[model samples]
Target: MKLNKILVYVIMILVLITSCKKDIVAGEVQDTEKKIECEEVEETPKEIVIDIDDIYNSVDIDIGYVELENLNEDNVPEIDLEYYPKDGDFILKKVSDGYICVSLEEYEDENALEDYLSPMVYRFNENGKLSWKKHYDYKTHVGKIGQVLTFDDDSFIFHIDSYQDWNEGRLINDNCYLIKCNKDGEEEWTKEYSNSNRDMLANILLSDSEEILIIGEWKAKDGKEYDDIDKGLKEELNNDIVITKLDAEGNMIEQKSFGGSNDEHVDIVGYDKKLGIIIEAISFSNDGPFAVDIIDKWNNDFIACIDEKNLEIKWIYRLVGGKYTTNNRFSINNGMVYMIVTQNNRNRQHSQSLITIDDKGNASKLITQTYDQMVDKFNSLMILQNGDIVIGEGNQYISSLRIFDDTGKVKKVIHDINLVPDEIIPTDDGGFIVKSRRQIKTVPQPIYVSCIWYDTELVMMKYDSNYNIEWRKTYDRYKNNPYWDCVIPLNNGKQITEIKTDYRKSCID
Candidate 1:
């Protein structure tokens, strides 16, 4: 009986050992399955490689006026013109489809001597094909379209200066209009603001909440009566700055004006929901210099911050100097304002200086770079995400782009003889897109005789993180009129620019 009981106990122990071995194998299998599942869940994103050759080859150079004429296609519609249509102002914004361009156009009136200006907006597909176009015209009034702001929903808002005069040549009325349109270029709503003062639209800003901010200059209606040599001209005119806010549906929520004695013209430099609005203005001096021969000159250049909610000035900083040219460029980044200002002397020699302003509106000069040899102008100024300031300075022939450190010292200079950089923008990959004009001439003349004498091309350059030129491509559609070229970068590492014809004849003979 004892031997039988011991054998039973041994059988039970063997059964227990077999169960333990099965549980261990199941746990290992479960862990391996979990590892496999995790490996399937995570994925590495694919990198987008842009084919430079493909993009270059896709350019439609035959779409311009001259090319269309050469084709003798009557189906093509005439593009509207503004004054010098070839030199019209344009604003470009990237959309999902591609790019939307809003341009100011002036049309020649067969009955009248002066041409009437209007606004035209065009939509293009991802491959740069024209999808649709919307042209706005107020039969009698001339329109000067200023800027366009696009929303996430693919809708856009554009502002224009609308004015009309009596047949007797006396000014009747002038007004500003804001028009909102849908993705199809159909007008959703239009708002017109009529003020006793003459107002000019400067720029449109998009807020963090997707609201619209209209910035402009306002001059008293009485100011138009004063002559150039009038002693009380500055006192008579109430030149001020105007700021207006609009909701998503084109409703004005708030409007405010700020100014003091002396003629003041304000420009909206930057704005943020948290930091409010930043503006730069110039106040003309009344007593300093006055003559019929002399034109308008500024006495004080000031920068100010305004509260977004209250519309009250938070702080004001001023830099006193001689005449301040319109080439002033300023940008705001990380609570700091960077500016490039040109001060003109009595001899018409201009000197450019770089300065910075803190959140408190305290102004400090970074470095004063003078251009005594030729007419040096600041074409573009941009602050990188890493706090570096890049400035493009150029004359008619040569151009240089200088990268300045955070402390305002020149870190490096990128120079080219024939390239005139008109604009520079930062890319997501820590590089830059330089929109420049390349002029090729036979001799090193101070000035090219005519558009026909020289070959000109619009250049788009891509730079690496180390500021090395990766590749560059040029377009010769509007070879002579580089001023009309507007290059906008796309999210997919592509670009779109204006294409026109060089209609002017060459004076080579």
Candidate 2:
């Protein structure tokens, strides 16, 4: 009986062990299946490589050329005038064939004591050659072209500040003019806009719905009439910011003005659907027209967002503590305003700061770099879609391009470049293009005379997202003859510039 009981216990223990072994094998199988499934689902993605040659070869950039020597002089009003290259702004717009440019020149009659403004428009072909040149009839009035906007059909309109009348035998620019022209350089219509005081055009912007927004300054006339023209008249005057909305047909729909007891000048403007009109300006007054209070009594640089519908000042952010501030450039991204400004300290030292202003009128300086005495005049600011900020700064002494993250941490910098960027434009392919100029040579004439000539070439550079230079092209065909100001890119991967020869200077006797 004892042997039989021992046999039964042994049999029970063997059965339990067999059941445990079967459960362990099943758990191992399930674990293996999960591991295989995870390995199949978590595959790594392939890296993308961008070919620089592909972008350059995409467009035929060397097809057409505009001969600067052969200017279209047809329909130009004849005058025995001495043309001088004026230091002004140049507006370039790309069309289907090429580009159109409008520039201003100051000319004087032999006997006249003062200089008058002449507006010149030029057209270039596909590869970028001058197709036609048009000179407006400025015999009756002195004026300068402020901005140009093109339509879908290649027709365009430009803003102009023209002399309203001969006030006491002096030509005063007291009115703003909107002149529309066809594709072939024919004037379609001319409209005049003026106020009780002198009006000057600052900029022109188009809304999303194709409406025109004309920004200018309206200054109270000093009420004193003069007999001679003053070249530096605007320096002594103060003006209020004026915004005039017009239909596509150059018809004024609404007009408004904003200012305080002192001077306010608008330098840059941007439009956003949610944020309304963004304005970068320099203000001198502490009250009136400002949505926020100004603490500093000196010249303060500010950023303001205005409601476009009713022309109300939404919010104004003044950059305090600086004695004098000057805004160079600004860009809007992700509901934030980023700009580059130069300010003066108590020791008379100049410093450049990259400032960010939020939508709620809050301002912060992201980075600041001080200059001893000479501040850089050529500066550009742009924010990429990926939250990277690109800033270009250069003087005659040095130049550089820097890329920083959203937190103002430096990512990459192309320092001590030979070219000075006149403008920096973002590309569609996550890169940027720089329109710049390089001083090729400098020739000092006879020591007895203060005659120095500089030979410069217009440079166009394309950079990749990693800040690697993809391609660079220099336009050195004009040498020391043509004086060009700006360069603009076209949709077809080309660039166009208007070359004006300053007839007033000659190194050779």
Candidate 3:
């Protein structure tokens, strides 16, 4: 036949060249498995570079809180400074071979007040030198040194505030001292408390069986005790809201008072081994003159829950808003209780509300968040250890730091242009430590005459678990106001702030 039809066309061209070499080896094995899954997603590791440049050390000492102990057995970190001295009458004594600043010799006549303000305690030594000091003179005429509770057997507690001139200078009154030192700073017991009207203190909590919960703002020794509350309320405001529980040897055991008629204050006191004492207040249903010229008409925001064995009042959540609320900020994890709520209109803050409350108090309102066009101002609120909910907003030129997730949503916002946060601290590697300041304010013109002038600086930022900004520091100290910086974070990663520049140069001289 023609040689069997040319061998059947060469066996159909060898089966079409083996199906084009199996489709080019299946597209080069699917592009080599997508290049080994993109090199394992670029070797995954998101960010953490911390080298804060030896954490800025500056100490002329006027600070009021900064603690990080190891005291000298030398595992490093030994900064504990809480100073006070603008012009001295000295008393810094601690001797086992290291501190002795005693210099009191200027009490010459006419009431002897050559600027002697007292309450000091320094102990630095990680190269900032000076390893011991202690001073506390009650020759008061005004003093404050609140919050400094450290102990794991190093013992310490001082939440002071003294004022003096009781009924003699016709009344000046102020007292809320707690003082309990020892780690060689000496003094063991001081607990004061006072009342005859006008008390101040504001917040302190320590419990885990060590108990100390304070909270303040009470003022009534004259408004006729509102004839014993609730008759239909409106007894014309007198402040009120005090809680006191002490004992770890500061002894006061139990004391309570909460108001209802008009002004109530107490803005935070937490504790939760299952939600026992949580009080956060701001009540005022009418303090007359149409609640001070109608700007939201009157306040009302409560959240109570006391009863860690008879402190009474188990649950109360009231929120009745109308717009003007104020800087409230809170946090408590696992058992709930978040609360943020800012909302304002008498000039600024435009909206914010987080609200969570649980452990039986119920209340929910997880996220309201609004800031109209920016004048934002609620500064601090943290709750992270993984439940994540950090928030801190500011004004006069940027300062943000949002981060929310746990269903509250927002998840990360940072910002920080002129800096102003007041405190944030949350780390263990999930990074965050903000404490900002930087104010500027200069008005001085005839533009509606109000006379303003400030300058302050004092920021300290350090973030990383991906919110990256591994370091930032500022410290001009003060020029017109704010000076209460406190940073403390060490275990070798370095950080210890609170340089209170002599109370901002004694408030600009």
Candidate 4:
């Protein structure tokens, strides 16, 4: 009996031991599975998300509660105020001493059969004192100034277009002339060029090798009268872009023409050491040799690089398809071309694109970016020394600046209500200077209606390296300054701006 009881006890103990071993194995297996799951989670990559709203919110800083003025108290030097014979276009340029203001004048009578246009040149000293004022009286010749280029040697040149009827054969055509002058406003030499029956100068530039490049539109005489523009003759005329190269002595060296059956117009001209003379132009013909590579059959703008040595086209790239708005800007840095193209799409949607082209004319990169609001146009483009690009955009309600990196990412944005940037100039202290126009509403007086007249004020704003506004100034003429022509930076960290003062009040309907 005792042996049987002991065997039963041993059997019970064996069963208990087996149960304990199974429980241990189950727990080990559960822990191993959990370790594997954790490893899998760690191996998976996390998606990166960039919040554009955060970026915008971070950089959109308030300028201030009040608009500050940093302009020098000396004010724009006032010169001898002369009565304008007639309303005509004028251009103001910065000189070593002060400023040069040139305007075209004509007789007050518009219906006169025989009249002449005069080129008026005025030089103002640094104190707004008139140094010399003169006008070229071209008898029986209609004259207009295209551009005035100033040199460091106290000399200047003016690109003039003169229209006259030849006394020999009664032939009527326009002539382009380069009039060089000394600092004393004395004419040095006058060089004349006749490309076609009608020649209109667009832009002029001085190359690194001291060659002068003149680009303009040239049209052959098609048995039309000189003043036939009243007959809507522009549609029937074939306008070709002509580029003429001249030496320092005002002697023509070479001339090149580019166009098709349709009309072509030049918008901008720039020069680069590697790309030579770069031209941005618009083409309306798709079947012509120059327009063959155009993307569409209608309006298109393109960039062409011409070889400086051979005076031949190096490469051309067309901006695929869209109606490019005005104020298109471009800059060349480190032998690369950076352009800002604002286009109005067919669907009425406006978009701005940043294009980069290499020396081989290869448009390697295109970054199409749009703002939240409907973008009107990009007015200016500036390439910094650090390969960063700064673009200015202005619409009816807002004006802002966008800074982009080399990869075309928006790194920063600046907003200012009172600033509508016309030009963005970078300063030497790693900051920026923005030149813009500000519109102010004058208080109503007994003589004029309330809120009907608006005055244009030229504004200049300086920013620090951190993109903070250092100072803002408005060159307040206070009278009837309706137009802000241009602004130039002076060496002493000051700015000189030109305001076209018309005493006649302009009414805004």
lDDT for residue 86 in candidate 2, whole number 0-100: 43
Q: Which ranges of candidate 3 are over 4 A from the true structure?
A: 1-120, 125-132, 139-198, 203-216, 221-237, 240-263, 268-280, 289-299, 302-318, 321-380, 383-465, 468-509
lDDT of 1: 0.62
TM per candidate: 0.65, 0.63, 0.28, 0.66
lDDT by residue (374-411, candidate 2, tens digit) is: 44642778887688998877653467888999999999
Number of the top lDDT candidate: 4
Residue 284 displacement (Å), model 3: 5.3
Candidate 2 segments whose C-alpha is farther than 4 A from its true place:
1-91, 96-98, 101-141, 152-154, 163-176, 181-189, 194-198, 220-238, 291-299, 323-327, 343-351, 369-378, 394-398, 440-453, 480-487, 497-509
Candidate 4 or 2, higher TM-score:
4
After superposing all C-alphas onto the true structure, candidate 3 shows an RMSD in angstroms of 25.3
CA-lDDT, candidates in order: 0.62, 0.64, 0.57, 0.65
Worst 10 residues of 3 by lDDT: 52-61
lDDT (Cα, tens digit) per residue for candidate 3, span 1-509? 34234434544544455565666876797689887774433345334332212111121212222221212223322344345344433333323333333322222346664443456666544444566665675544555554666655656676555556544447656555667877766888986666342255667777667787776666542233433555455444477676778787787887766664456676667788678778766666355211322224334556777876567777777665554335555778877888776655555436777778887888777678666534555667878778888877775355677888878888778774455566777777777767665543332233224323334556566676777766665555433445434344542334654443454223211
Question: lDDT tens digits, residues 402-437, model 1?
Answer: 888889888889885346667777877777777665
Q: Which candidate number would show the highest TM-score if scored against the true structure?
A: 4
List per-candidate RMSD values in Å: 28.4, 29.2, 25.3, 27.1
Between the candidate structures 3 and 4, which one is better when assessed by TM-score? 4
Arranged by TM-score with the best first, the candidates are: 4, 1, 2, 3
